[model samples]
Target: MKNKTLLTVLSIIGMGLLLGWFILQMKPPHVNEKSTPSANQQAQTKTNSPEEKYIALTPEAQQKAGIRVKVAGPVQIKTVLELPGEIQFNENRVAHVVPRVEGVITAAYKHLGAPVEKGELIAVLESRELADLKSQYYTAIKRRELAQITFDREARLWREKVSAEQDYLAAKTALAEANIVVTAAAQRLLALGLTQDALDTIPQESQSKLSRYPIRAPFDGRVVRKHVVRGEAVKADAELFMIADLSTVWGTITVYTEDLNQVHLGQKVTVRSEELGLEATGTISYLGYLIDAQTRSTQAHVDIPNPEERWRPGLFVTVEVAEKKIPVPVAVAAEAIQTYRNQPVVFVQHGNGFEVRPITLGRRSGNGQWIEMVNGLSAGERYAADNSFVLKSELGEAMAPQ
Candidate 1:
């Protein structure tokens, strides 16, 4: 009985030991609680140990790469009011040439876009009206000559008492009437576009040339429009040609109701055309008092010097009017800012190299040359100003697959 009891006890102990061994085999391998981290702890560690990006460029390399550096500090940020505009001819310098008398265009000396000097002949007209006026003037001159001879004879007779006094008085009256007629005719020709010198030559000119009327340019300019052709008849007050002096141009800007208060005469303006890659500085020359009812906008003009004639009329441009200037604590060149990982970053001068720092941008200058920094930058920080893209390119290559 005792042997059976001991065997039972040993079998019970063996079963207990086998159950414990199976549980141990099913459980995972031993791991130290102190050494292993939880999910939150792992995430925290990863958040703390962020990969830093930098560009390793020497001063010599930077110079060779055309990378310029500048120190950040307080800068004046211009608040600009940008408006769309169009180039136009300066109205004060433009002219519409017209023929003062009705006539046929016998000759057209200038074509469209032809340059003309002041008093240069542009066309000639043959008009019967002009011939009639000349005829009247010459007829009066002949009568005056006859009257003068008669008056001289009458005066001598009156002094010698060889002629009756009544006869002498009648001859003198005829001479005075002739002189008045001649003076009146000359004044009429002067009013008909004839210079005093031209009138003097009328007596020497042939009858065939009496009807010839020359049209002259009033000022130095280019012919922008021509309405009459050779052999074409034109009327008085007809627009013969349009001339414009293109040395200066007008940049006409539309100032909305909201912007009218900000724009004023004598304000400095910058005109830019992206399509032509042209830029010019000017001042507001005119501001309209009336607002257009349809567009709800007022017109303003900037007089831009266009000596090269590059700023042609009808070109669309941007007019930037400087408003108030605000001083910002930090600012950098617009070229210094770049995009990295979908964030705005600037390459700051770090120890022996440049470090990519994210930034919060604020306002930008009216000229787009500088930008204000709201965060991630401070005064006195050295940064890449011009050609900062070189550093960005270098950073990209370094981060690329090796």
Candidate 2:
């Protein structure tokens, strides 16, 4: 029985040894420690690497993208007030010509778009009423001449005792009445815009010039509108022409309620027209006291000297008023600012890479073409002046899913 037990125990030991060998064979294969990295080493590699916010571009790519870089620096920041306006006729230089008497138009020497000088004849009128006045003037002159001769003769006769005193006195009285009549007729012609020279030059019994009345220009200007034609009858209150001197024009700016306080007389204003490629400088001449109820704006006038008359009435234009001048430590082109991660960022240049720099912005200039950098930027740092969006786009691509 002792020998059987010993054989059984030896069998058990053999089975245990075989099981141990199988377990050893089933274990994972060995690997080189130097070839594979630890978790801490992988994390250190990630921490040492540069962030994805930067984008590198070749010199050729930058040139092709039209990215212009400029150094941030101090600049003069002007607070300008820009407003929409229109070119208009200067009211002070505009005239509405009118005739003073009812007459038939005999001649028209001026037409629309005609340039005229002061006192230049614009038209001629013929009137029977003028003719009657001239005839009366002539009769008064003749009567006065006859009365003077009679008075002279009667006075001589009375002094020589050849005629009675009563006859001489009566002749003197008739002369006085005749003189009064002549004076009355001369005053009447003067009231009709006829000069003293014209009255004194009237010919005796002149039928040819009696009914002629000339309408002349009041100032040197261009005839913009004409309402009279030859042979057409015009009344005393008729507006015959509209003449305007284009040497100076008005730039009418519509000032909103918010801008009303900023505008004032004597402020320098610049007027520009994109369509005509014209620019002019002038001073604010007027400001309306009342605001328009519908537009909630007021009218401001700038007297622009249009010596060439390039600014025509009704032409739309933009007006820039110089409000105040400000000094800024750091200024940049407005286009340099871009949005990244929902914040304003400007691309700053490194060696061959551009870094996305977040910035705090101050008030933009009234022109909106320049901006002030309050923080996150230093003077002398090279930054993208224009076309920075290309860099921003490249950065987005770099951060995208790989």
Please, what is the TM-score per model? 0.84, 0.73
Residues 1-402 of candidate 1 have per-residue lDDT tens digits of 999999999999999999999998896778898698989898777544312476778889989988888999999888898999999999999998887778999999999999999999999998888899889999998999999999899889999999889888998999999989988999888877789899888889998999999989888889999999999888878999999999899999999999988998899889999999999999999999999999999999999999888999999999998889999999999989999888899989986688888899999998788899999999999999889998888888777788
TM-score of 1: 0.84
lDDT of 2 at 369: 76
- lDDT against the true structure, per candidate, is 0.90, 0.89
- Clash totals, every prediction: 0, 0
Estimate the overall C-alpha local distance difference test score of candidate 1. Answer: 0.90
Per-residue lDDT tens digits of candidate 2, residues 302-351? 99998888999999999998778798999889999998888898988989
- Provide the clash count, candidate 1: 0
Structural RMSD, model 2: 5.9
Displacement of the residue 225 alpha carbon in candidate 2, Å: 0.5
